[model samples]
Target: MENVAILVDGAFFIKRALHIFGKLTPDELASKLCSYSEKHLARDRKGERNKLYRIFFYDCPPLQNKVFHPYHQQQIDMAKSERSIWRLQFHDELRKKRKMALRLGRIDDINVTWRINYDKIKKLCSGRLKWHDLKEEDFSMDVKQKGVDMRIGIDITSLALKKQVTQIVLISGDSDFVPAAKFARREGIDFILDPMWAPIKEDLYEHIDGLRSTFPKPCNKKKLESSY
Candidate 1:
């Protein structure tokens, strides 16, 4: 009797699903996730009652202030609205500062180049081009309101330490979780990595007991019907 616990990174899962399936209604996304979990459990021989311990959903809410492109907003809204699962947990304001830093660096380069080129292009046309209002405050980086990684790390570590679950399933592709996976393996738990719709890294697979991509299966029609 193996007890399995699933830890899902909501933001990562939603983004990957959107990229893979195109636009999906909230119900559609939830159905896909439910199907994914069930299939994994079946494959692991733990789909039966009492064998599956619990599924822990971990994710930070979207940056409320940052303007999400319309399509992204739809997906984000749908994920937050899902509240049917008892094990689901919400962690808000989890910011990805490193990714943000990299984006800001690229924006700075674009700004410098635009400053040099914009005036020249305008002069050639004998006209002035007005730059859109830009502000440093718009690019400021701060702590994520949700702190997803911290929450996820804590849950994985605590569960592994307590030996509550014989197997752990992580539904994320972020390399930030390598340490947690390693720790789980050291504690003799079978760590499985399932990047629902994302690419699985070879290095990540090396640290886990197995790797499974959950994007090929059909989504749960029942859940999709409810999302709308």
Candidate 2:
């Protein structure tokens, strides 16, 4: 049986899981995640599944301090925020899982600011946009995940070179891992990407061995309720 390393992008999973499973608390998400990993990402080509070498979950600690969201014109207090509290609890939940390695990255909050997309701003000025005008993505908080990408790259390289596992499955939509994926495949690792049904860049197709999403797309509220 091929040994698999399940690497998850915590932020990506959290945001998407909320859409899939309505109102998922951190504790609930952790339970669902473990079940999902075992069922989906840990399988070999012959359809026989094995326990993971380690489930590597990468995320930064939640901001426990207060910060300002300039566009929303409000002081977001992480210390008192429900989401922040949930995130920290979520990390604890992951930590307690056997063979689950929670790889942490640092969050940079020093110069966080609201950054408006220039293209969107220009369109608004020229009256060419309406559907997405005033949307949240049009203006985003420019906070950086300082070491997440670097850590992921290093881990992938180390795993490949050390022959840590025969199969490497990364659950991320970020194309930044293309290089790492390519390198892993070159080292004769079965590199798979589980974008969790998210759309990825066209170029990312070339680097990975295969695409396999464990989670099917979540149905609408009515369909979900009817199934039950």
Say which candidate scores most in lDDT: 2
Indicate the TM-score of model 1.
0.58
TM-score winner: 2
Candidate 2 C-alpha lDDT tens digits along 136-178: 5466555577788888899899999999888888988999898
Return the clash pairs for model 2, or none.
none
Worst 10 residues of 1 by lDDT: 97-106
Task: Please give, for residues 167-216, the per-residue lDDT of candidate 1 as tens digits.
Answer: 88888888888888899899999888887645566677688898877567
Q: Which lDDT values do the candidates have, in the order given?
A: 0.57, 0.78
Report lDDT (Cα) of residue 192, candidate 1: 85
